[model samples]
Target: MIVAGFGWRTGANLGAIRSALASAQQGQPPVTALAAPHDKLALVSPLAEALGVAMIAVSPSALQSSPTPTQSPASLKARATGSVAEAAALAAAGPGAWLLTTRHISPDRTATCALARSCTEGPAQ
Candidate 1:
């Protein structure tokens, strides 16, 4: 399964998120699931509905525990992670999953997205 994780500034519109997700998924497999911080379910729900995929609300601890290739100073200080989008994608993709792309920023810089592929082939949670 392929999961796309997201990170967005407060009040960012769905268009910004869609743009970032489009960049992240460029040339990649179609995403079967979506994920974001547990506290940001409200922000992700609309995207999930639009994409017609399941979405996971990953905890902050889970996001912090997941290692990512890209590091962001703001995210490190605020969320104790490198990139929330990368970490959420890794976490949601479950064990043995690997990142397919690094975080991709929206044109407006209001949102970010990353893709990860699950080692096991099946529907994503």
Candidate 2:
């Protein structure tokens, strides 16, 4: 499965989320699920519905353990991770999943997106 995870600031709108997802995908595989930190469920739910995909709420502990190559001081301070989008995508994609897109921020910089695919496909290209 391919999962797209998001991280966004308060008051982020659907446009920001959609823009970030588009930037992350770049004509890649379809995203089967949308993921975000549990606290962000309210924000992600609408996006999931719009995308017609399931939403996965990743736990704080899982986000911390998921490795991400990028680092964001703001995200690290808020969620104990450098990249919430990347960590959430990896967690929701389940064990052995790897990142296809690290993190792509929206034009407004109010949201970010990351993509991950199941390990069954081997390492992410």
Q: List the global CA lDDT of all models.
A: 0.91, 0.92
Best by lDDT: 2
TM-score of 1: 0.94
Task: Please list all clashing residue pairs in model 2, or write none if there are none.
Answer: none
**Model 2, range 1-125, lDDT digits (tens) per residue?**
99999998888888998999999999779999999999888878987998799999999999999989999999999999889999999999999998998899999999999999978767644
The reply for model 1, stretches above 4 Å from the true place, is 122-125
TM-scores, all models, native as reference: 0.94, 0.94
Count of backbone clashes, every candidate in sequence: 0, 0
Clashes of 2: 0
Quantify how close model 1 is to the true structure by its C-alpha RMSD in Å: 2.9
